[model samples]
Target: MATRTASCSCGQLRIEVNGEPLGVGVCHCLSCQQRTGSVFAALAAFRTPYTVTGEAREYLRTGDQGGRFLFRFCPVCGTNLFHTEEDVGDRSVAVAVGGFADPSFPPPEASVYDCRRHGWVVLPADVTVYDKDPE
Candidate 1:
């Protein structure tokens, strides 16, 4: 199994994951854009039981799909680290792709919130797209 490591900008927070990610994808919802301060937010989901180090500040917000979204960031440098889904129970955890120390992490297989994506942002021709949520 491959172990991935990540850290905040100030190096105050660090995370190490054992094995590969559960999934990876980009979210184009308005909330995601606002939270990430970008056109879309990239995320890598993983199963529990991984080693996570350092203390991170968190913010919780509700999503358009009525799911509760949590954002965890470094309190010092304000580096976004990971997030958790309230609606999907507690078995899954999502880490920001940018936080990964690996340069060749898994690419996103699908995209969400296509309805809110920027017109100039063209998606891959073969990837699955969701207008709103995956459901």
Candidate 2:
């Protein structure tokens, strides 16, 4: 198992994972773009038992599919660090890939909401793309 740590811009909030992510993906949904203030959002999902440090503020939003998502961010820097789906229980947490600040972090395995993907954005040929959330 490898240990990886991700933190907010101000380093006030941090998440430490004990093992590699169970899955990595990029989402191009409109909400994701707005949430990240970027063309898309890249995330890595990890099983529970990870560690979190520092104070965080949370925001709850409803997904396009009507599922609730709870996002946690650093209260100091206002950086969105991670999120979890309300319907999924506490089995996993999705962390923003940029928080790791590692260029070598694994590439995304899936691209969701490709229907909304920016025309200028190009993904690796090997990535699995979904026009929308996979059924």
Candidate 3:
């Protein structure tokens, strides 16, 4: 159970994970790009009860699958940094891979929502590519 720490650009928001990721992936959905202000969104999913520090700004939005989601960010730097779900309960939260101080985080195991992926976006053939999460 190795713990990992994550923090926002301005260090205003921080989080710690106590175990391996439940799943890791890159999301190319339009909503994700718009929210992250990037071509894609990469995340590491973790179980609940992780420690988090600092203040964060959050907003509720609907997902492509018609599910409600909460986007969390660093209030000071306005960096879209994490994702949380009411259905997942308080025990778990998804951390944006970019928020980690380490730059060598594992590559995404999958690329999801590829239907909306940018035309120029390219992924390795070995990576699992899905129109959306297969499960």
- Whole-model lDDT for model 1 versus the true structure? 0.83
Clashing residue pairs, backbone N/CA/C < 3 A, model 1: none
- Give the per-residue lDDT digits (tens) of candidate 1, residues 13-131: 88777778888888999888988789998888887766668888989998776788788899988888888888888787888898876678777888999999899987767778999
- Encode model 3's per-residue lDDT on 19-127: one tens digit a residue: 8888788999888888889999999999988887888778998765566678888889998878787665776688999888677788788999998899898887777
Task: Evaluate model 3: give its lDDT.
Answer: 0.84
Which wins on lDDT, candidate 1 or candidate 2? 2
Whole-model alpha-carbon lDDT for candidate 2:
0.95
Q: Which stretches of candidate 1 lie over 4 Å from their true place?
A: none
Residue 38 in candidate 3, Cα distance off native in Å: 0.7
Model 1 vs. true fold: TM: 0.90
Arranged by lDDT, best first: 2, 3, 1
Rank ordering of all candidates by TM-score, starting from the highest:
2, 3, 1
- For candidate 2, which ten residues in a row score worst on lDDT? 15-24
The number of the candidate with the highest lDDT is 2
Listed in order, each prediction's TM-score against the native is 0.90, 0.97, 0.91
Writing each residue's lDDT as its tens digit, candidate 2 over 4-87 gives 999999999999987889999999999999999999999999999779999999999998788999999998999999999999
Measured with C-alpha atoms, the lDDT of residue 80 in candidate 2 is 98
